[model samples]
Target: MPKNKMKSGTFIAMCVVTVLFIVMPLFLQVSVIRNAIAWILSGLRYQEYKSAYLGLVGGLLGSWLAITGAIYTQRKFDREKEEKRAIEEKRAKEIDKENIKEICREMLWSEIRQNDNSLSCDNGNFIKAIMEKNDCYFYNRDSHRITTDNWNFIIDKVISMDLELAIKLMHLYKYYEFMTDFDGSADSAFTKSQLDFSKYKECYQDVVEYLEFPWAND
Candidate 1:
């Protein structure tokens, strides 16, 4: 038998022996031994009832402890999971910034390489068309007129003597607003195709050396 079972059996045998030895003699003092035996039996029944009540209380307390522990563990795990997700999202944004920088570098180099003075007016016309399509009007603040002409002007100036003239012209013609639309992916096609930057660091250096622009900080 199991150890607990053996212990319980030994306890029960001792209770039986005590009832026989002690209660039997007490009953002899009474008119009949049967009444003493009945009294002893009633006491045993009361003891069994007390044991059952104590067992129930102990079981309920144990269950409550287990439930409390489980709730605490679950909450801890959820907090850790949320922390990990936040870290991953932050890392993803950093990677995206790096990728955008790389693409912008490549576009700048290509524009420098393929640039021909003969096509300057053509480039200006193309930029004008883009501005008209986007409704980028220079004179009117409310007018939508982001033209290809303005972009061509900036490009030609940058190609000739770097971005000094372009920067001055930009300040004169609301270049900040024009850049806002360009950055918003409004001119995604022109940015991808025409505004090529193959010599990444060199082109960036040219801008930094010559232009006083906000995007240079980026």
Candidate 2:
């Protein structure tokens, strides 16, 4: 049988034995049990009638043990569920990291070819025009001035197929965009901001147009 059922059967058997040995003899007027009870309660004022009190205490203790065991089992189940959730979250993060790596690799090589004028003639001028429009400012702490090196580094890294480096550069640009507006203005920093969308739109269009490459078809 199942372990739970076996334990329940054992407890029932024990309770039956206890009731037969203790409670049954008390009502039957057994001499030996009566003498034992009398000796156990000899020092008490209510010595002749302590069996009921003792039985009550035993009942309370048994109920407490059962309740405590149930609480412990519930906690064990909750802990197992929490551990399983953590494992699933960890697996999902690993899969996301792998996918990001693959996308970064493909985009990097495509940028490199486009930058070097090695891409198809139809797409070469389009890529160069978009790169020219890709301008953003960066902080130059050594020079104590804001400059456009952030945009330059991102473009270079992307063209070199260094996706990790490109992401880092992009973060730097985002940081400065949030930090200071050299344009001298005090406004809601993150509320409403403008982006030069021309370059972005052109690049996206180019990507869609080039999606029919022979390798991509395969």
Candidate 3:
């Protein structure tokens, strides 16, 4: 059991014992028990009995003080240790973010964004044409395009820094995955076109804004 629990149990037991010591006589009709209790109480009048009583009281007080001090010391140590652990964890996360930021900086965002913009614009135009019910055959022009590879490394860490960015990033990449999937399991382009591409555009813009801060500058 924990030290605090043990101490609390001990204290409760002591209180119960003390209460019984005082109250038991009132309930019990035994004359011998009452006489014994009376004799011990009357003995307080003698110097030897008083000294022994004082010694017992002094011993209990000393033990209580010692136990209380030890508990306080242990609690203080535990609190300090917890605080230190939290500080270290915070520091580690900050360091991890910085490292991730460095990785992002190494990536050529300008070039990647340019490619993404061109591809998304073309796809949007195609979707618009198809939505118009144009009889032309749909061609997947951006099928070969891949934009999420560089981001896979730090994508998980980005959530801690900017959850919205992480969510948008995942949303856009999921669309990309859907577009690239040529298997029969994938949905038709017309079905995929009905999605809100504006969100993906917003995601791109957010990524640009997030990475263009002074700390992430080229």
Candidate 4:
């Protein structure tokens, strides 16, 4: 047995000896120990018929507490299991989204890298096509619009990922919107010479650099 059990047994034995010898013989001369033992026994037996209901109430209260404790423990375990499952599912989704982002980056950057670097008068058509207020520009027509749907699917996810990249992408979006609005206006010129190309180049580089290569191909 454990030391606590041994100690408890020894203490109980000492208490019994004290009750039988010291309390019975020396301290309680009028048989007080007997009276106390009888009183305890009578209480256990519910002394009178009318008072018996109190014992039943106490028993029912103890049972209700035990049932409550059991329910609480089960609920706690279920909550922990649910939390673990949610965490694992989120991690798996992030991994899948990261893979998709990599593919989109490769396609977008492939076009950006190959295109004209200089902001000369020679690249007017390419610039307007990109900055045009239509589905074609936002869909990345110059890059064959490859994986554009996949790109949209992960955009919010990407914004939540990298701070620098998110800032760059936001600026690029603002510029794109500005160009679209400008192109729609009657005051707009036949040539988009007023637009700055270097600013766009920086945004593209920031986005491309932040994107990771797909695991299978990398």
Candidate 3 lDDT at 147 equals: 48
Best by TM-score: 3
| Candidate 2, 1-218: lDDT as tens digits | 96655555656665665666556656549788777767767766673457677677678757755765575566668778999999998897666555544554455445433422321123444223333442332222333233433355444645445454455545434433433343311122212234332333344334333433333322
Looking at model 1, which ten-residue stretch has the lowest summed lDDT? Answer: 112-121
* Candidates' RMSD to native: 19.4, 15.4, 8.2, 12.8
Task: Give every collision pair in model 2.
Answer: none
lDDT of each: 0.44, 0.47, 0.58, 0.48
Steric collisions counted per model: 26, 0, 0, 0
| Candidate 4 residue spans exceeding 4 A from truth | 1-46, 49-54, 115-202, 213-218
Candidate 2 is scored at a TM of 0.37
Candidate topping lDDT: 3
TM-score for all models, in order of appearance: 0.32, 0.37, 0.59, 0.43
Q: After superposing candidate 3, which stretches have Cα over 4 Å from the reference? A: 1-45, 108-112, 122-146, 153-166, 181-190, 213-218
Ranking by lDDT: 3, 4, 2, 1
Error of 2 at 215 (Å): 21
Better of 2 and 3 by TM-score: 3
What is candidate 4's TM-score against the reference? 0.43
lDDT of 1 by residue, 43-114 (tens): 546777756864675575555445544554565687689889999987876665455334434443334322
Model 3 lDDT, residue 98, Cα: 69
